[model samples]
Target: MKPIVAIVGRPNVGKSTLFNRLLGHRRAMVDDSPGVTRDRNYADISRFDKPFILIDTGGFEPVTEDRLLQQMREQSTMAMEEADVILFMMDARSGLTPADIEVAKMLRRVKKPVFYLVNKVDGDKLEHESAEFYTLGVDRFYTISAEHNRGVLDMVDDLMDTLPDVAEPSDREELTKIAVVGRPNVGKSSLVNRLLGYERVVANPTAGTTRDSVDTLFMCNKKPYLLIDTAGIRRKGKTVEKLEKYSVVDALRSIERADVVLVVLNAEDGVTEQDERIAGYVHEAGKACVFVINKWDALDKDNATFGLYVEKVRMEFKYLAYAPILFVSAKTGQRIGKIIASVDEVMEQYTRRVSTSEVNRIFTEATESHHAPLAHGRRVKFYFATQVGTRPPSFVIFTNQPESVHFSYERYLVNRFREAFGFNGTPLHLMFRGRDKKTLARQAHNPA
Candidate 1:
């Protein structure tokens, strides 16, 4: 799991600005759709040397002063509890306030490393003004302009150096970690039991390989898989009854550990708000996921029922357009075999790699089919594109006007790539960058 680094501060202190700045290119995709609050605040940040999850606690618009401060206090307290590292931001322009001191006091109590940040320090003058914050603080503060990228890199670099055990992607190809997560009693245990009873492996799992979650090694058609089920895992002194609500935390932990997630939904209940949030977390985490509608036997179906259900799911999870959905009954064991078959196929696409020439060719065709609209009176052009990484294949597309490229056009290019090469059950990241056409041409001719 990537370490979660959160930005917590009072309203209008540039928390969101710093969040967007840290995100860089991934910003657009993270804030893709309107009305998606969960995704808007949390982003999978990987551009930097040390990757982490960046959370913006300042998601709301400024309200009445008293209420906003109250909200900020609540937000800061919650952030301190959850985040691995906390970034306490104070506005250099506004100067230190009672709220900043209150938040600082809270931060002082936490065992985690709390970075004191004085934002909006645009110049040496403001940097000097930022020193007023030191009255309540013991350690030094980093003065930064989150909007202009001033002193932000230095702060992040120092924080990264201080943070220990950053979760880097493993090079070794090991057992595929599959997590089964859903609302409590949503047939999570039933499905896990069925799967284990059906395909539990002969040999015991090696020692010293256990995760915080309960993991069982199983085989499907001679292939190995390590099951990370949210249901089987129990927190100390927490009863199964309490787990209904508490399992959400466990589910998130399971997601962080798994490469692929099985977002199981109870057919009788249909799609709940919790289900959508859980699935949204999977998408946010960039894990290849499949939606399993469990207890399909309970739902009385007509010819139109399945289609209607599928359409509703598509509507709810508009962002997860790529994930494959399966209608299965863990009780009946109907269509059980299809689960692994689909997983195998999806993994193939999830870890798929397209050659640079082919990647550029598809983008070329995509633009030819629907030319990217001109932005700011200049014609937008794509010089070249190369698949940078795969685990949800990411591409860095060199373009003349990187900033001018519209989000819709980027989405169009993503659709085109998907059409040409099926990226089923996976998300695609297309990062636009500024590169000269001459440079691309030289590289193209040389064929590195």
Candidate 2:
């Protein structure tokens, strides 16, 4: 299970702002109003290569039968109950309050790791004043300006060091990881909620409700897979707020860690340049990708019209022609099951293993079908091949002279491997190794 970190603090203390900063997105609604956030938001947060679950709790307001504030308090308490680490946030600008002391007392009873944070410490004066938070008895403290992003990285770095060095699951061996990525309000979280068969992830009509990359683990065909529901990714120039900028960064980071990325496009809006950019990131990362045309039920499609849109999407993202596209309605649960099954199939194909003999046979057939280009008066001889790894299947090809192998020929080999093996919706890696003394020694031992 991923480690859980909870952010708890009073209203207007920048808990949501800190949440946005840590997650690199404005997932939580950040307003001047004290009780803007009503529910606990959870996201899969990563700093560097380390990944952990982060929960953003609503502002702690004294309960007196007001339905919404009461719910907020309950959510904050629930977050504390589920947290592996709790961040007790206070406002350096506002100074300590009775509510802050109350929240600290509440956190003290919980037997989990807790850190005291003073937010809005943008300058040296506020940083010094933040030292007063030591009275809360939480030994760990970080002074940060979430809005300006001051000292945020230092806090993250310290958190990374404090995190226990637990054994992380290998990307290949762990259940297949599929990320849902797209622009704001494109129903990415809605799709995740449908897949999990419940409202595990909060889905709202408001743009950027799902702030962090929230992950939910479930079994498909008894194979464990993680579904990473990330914040909306907007184009760089379109981002006006510091929070939105962070959200985009978080979305891209989610794609970087995923084995397969499901790029959700708004069916009503068709495809946009932002969609193309998002798809580009997946292809550039060398990850298997699947295009999800969400809210298809709302689209006025008549048979051939859907086909045209698909073709258009393919044309727009020609580099990702290898990626498969699926249509679904997260609100109505239309085609949701098929989406899960397709993800499983793509993951299986991604991690598919091939025998050395089969690889050699296919190599021979491919070479005969399209001979390797001649270079420098010597015929480029591709002798043998073997599977080196999976999770984006990589192979090493033994050649007479590795340096003689042109990049175009390598692409040809990779295309041939895809044609023969059907590693659909996955990237392929090819490496050239010169036939040297080590190769001869291995051959001599085998004597075949």
Candidate 3:
């Protein structure tokens, strides 16, 4: 776990802009519109070899009766609560408002260090406009422009000195990271809370309530696992807000880092294109996956309903045919235990290794069943095959003509490996490589 640094401020005060500037990339959504970022978005940033988790949250709404605005306020407040250090931004152009003063009062309750940033001080003319902010009685402050990246590094230099030292968790076995990802309102957070037996993440009827990819440490049957509850991923066309766009990126990043990704689908809605797209990310990343069809209780169930729903998921995610599917109701705890069981099972296969002799035996049987295709009037000669890596079970085959090994033949070889050793709920990476003279000599002396 990295130290957390959160950015909080009133609406349209350039909080997101400063967040992107600090990240040195357009990760947080920025726009002239107020409240564009409704939820918190975080990323890992390293400066001068020091890494920390930087969180970009929605603008702080001091007082609002609107349902969404209140939710956004709660989201920002949560960031401030979790942050080791907080950056409270104010717009220099707008000078000072009662809302900013109220925000300052809110920060006063927080014991953590808060940095006052008067953003949009692009020139000397606006520098004087930031002086009045001292009325809030903050001991230290900086006049900077988040859009132009002016004086931003100076603020970071000071904040770096204040970051608290975090001790890492000492566990004998590495924690298994499981990322739960799906479209908006798909019961992702609900599933997380169910697994944790608590409301670890905010789960509402509203779409996109959980914006950030929040991680929670979980222990099940004496096994430690990190459950990453990610934001709802919207389609590119529907992701108009810059905040939501970055939220999607954050969710995808969580998937990339996960050992096993739980691709949650809403059974009430059936399988949609976006669900398949999310599964595509898991497949592309070569991560082990379990298809979790949530909201099963909401669907009208009959004798064949479960089978029909499973078939629908299979049809939509045909590429992920190897993944295990579980029909779970997050609201009712229906078959939720099977998710963890599947995760453990998949993880075992994900890191499974095969001996060189076993690999050769499987390869020989596969070739005997269906010989290699002929290229240039000669059969594509496969010399040796070995397991090069795990975590999706990677294998490399040394052949006379690597290019001559067609994709269908590669698929056949992968199927053979799966049949020999049940590589369930994981992808197989089979690489065809042609041997060179030096490599062939080395292999002759020390065979793979």
Point out the higher-scoring one by TM-score: 1 or 2: 2
Tens-digit per-residue lDDT, 1-448, candidate 2: 6788899888788988888788887666677867655556667776555688888877787544766566568768878888888888889989978788888887778887787888889899988887777787776778888899987788777777767766665663466888999999999878987888866665767787665666666787768887888888887897886667767887788898798899999999999988889889888887888899999999776879877998899899987877888988998988888887788778887889898778888988988888778889889877678888887888888788789888888888888898999976788888888877677458534534
lDDT of 3 by residue, 1-448 (tens): 6788899988889988887787878755567888776667666687544678888887787888877777778878888888989999999999988999999998998998989999999999899778898999989889999899899889888887888666656765788999999999999989998998965666779798776687666689988898888889999999997768878998999998899999999888888889888889899999999999898888877899978877887887877889999989999999999999999999999999998778888898888889988988988877778888988899989888998888889888988888889986789999988987678657745765
Q: What is the TM-score of each candidate against the true structure?
A: 0.56, 0.71, 0.86
Of models 1 and 2, which has the larger lDDT?
A: 2
Tens-digit per-residue lDDT, 233-267, candidate 1: 23334433432333445467778878788998888
Superposed model 3: Cα runs more than 4 Å off: 166-177, 193-257, 373-376, 436-441, 444-448
Clashing pairs in 1: none
Q: Which candidate should be chosen as best, given lDDT against the real structure?
A: 3
Give me the runs in candidate 1 sitting further than 4 Å from their true place: 1-173, 198-212, 231-247, 445-448
Looking at model 2, which ten-residue stretch has the lowest summed lDDT?
A: 439-448
Clashing pairs in 2: 24-246, 24-247, 25-246, 25-247, 27-211, 44-213
lDDT (Cα, 0-100) at 105 in candidate 2: 83
* Candidates sorted by lDDT, best first: 3, 2, 1
Shift of residue 186 alpha carbon in model 3, Å: 2.5
